[model samples]
Structure formats: C-alpha cells, structure tokens
Target: MNDQTKGIIAWIIIGLIAGLVASLIVGGAGSIIGWLIAGLIGSVVGGFLAQRFDIKLNLGNPFFEQVIVSIVGAIIVLIIAQIIT
Candidate 1:
C-alpha cells in the first residue's frame, strides 16, 4: 500500500484501541462507529496536546506512541462528552 493507505490503516487501529480503553476508563459506551469517531477525534486532540505540551513517548514504536497519546486524548473527549450530556 501507499503511504496514505498505511497511515489511514494505522490511524484506524490506533483509534480502535484508544477508543475502547477510554470508554472503559470513563464508563462510556459506544458501537464500532462510535469508537471510530472517538478514536479519530482523539488522535487529532492527542496530536495537538502533544505539540502544545511537548508530550513524548520513548516506546520505540510509533504505533504504541500513537496508542498512548490517543488513549489520553480519548479520555479527555469522553469527559467532555459526559459534561456536555
């Protein structure tokens, strides 16, 4: 696959993992579509937070790094959703 395809696939995987973990932690629930939405949004949020706060992971694996960041971001998203609802 091309670089774009790879990146998209990576993001999906990261989103699934992050969404599930965040939902579990925050006592939120969702379907596959919900998880995907949360995960994608989480990825963006995580990236922004990392850039703003200089968050870094020395996991030596980009996938793991993304997962960790995504999870944190997803948690924040869940909290906001809770507050808003």
Candidate 2:
C-alpha cells in the first residue's frame, strides 16, 4: 500500500489500542469503536500538539517517535473525552 494508506492503518491500530489502554487506566467500559474514534481524533490533535511543541514526527524510520506521539495523543484524547462525558 501507499504511505497514506499505511498511515491510516497505523492510526486506526494505534487508536484502537490507545483507547483500550486509556479506558482501562480510567476504569471505564471498553468500546473498540469509541477507542477507534478517540485514536483518530487523538492522532490529529497529537500531531498538531507535537508540532506546536517543536516535537517533530518522523515520516520515515523513526518508530519510537511515532509511538510517543501516539501515546501522548491518546492521553490527550482520553482527557478530553473524560471532560466531555
């Protein structure tokens, strides 16, 4: 697949996983769909936040950086969702 496609898949996976993790940490019901949504939203928010913080996301082989971004993004999403819910 292309880079964009790969990125989408990556985000979905990350979102799903992050959601589950966040929900567990927050002691809430586990919803894959919800997690996926949060993950997707988190991806966007995280990307923007990272950029604003001068933290660069690698489009290449830097896997760790991406993971960090995903986790941070997931955390942000969880926080927002907590407030909204």
Best by TM-score: 1
Please count the clashing residue pairs in each candidate, in the order shown: 0, 0
How far in Å is the alpha carbon of 84 misplaced in model 2? 2.5
- Per-residue alpha-carbon lDDT of model 2 for 2-41, expressed as tens digits? 9999987876787777666666666443577877776667
Top-lDDT structure, candidate number: 1
Report RMSD for candidate 1. 1.0
Tens-digit lDDT track of model 1 for 7-76:
8898898998888888888867478777877878888899899989997898999889989999989889
RMSD of each: 1.0, 3.0
- Model 2 spans > 4 angstroms off: 27-29, 56-61
lDDT of each: 0.87, 0.70
How displaced is residue 11 in candidate 1, in Å?
A: 0.8
Window of ten residues with lowest summed lDDT in model 2: 21-30
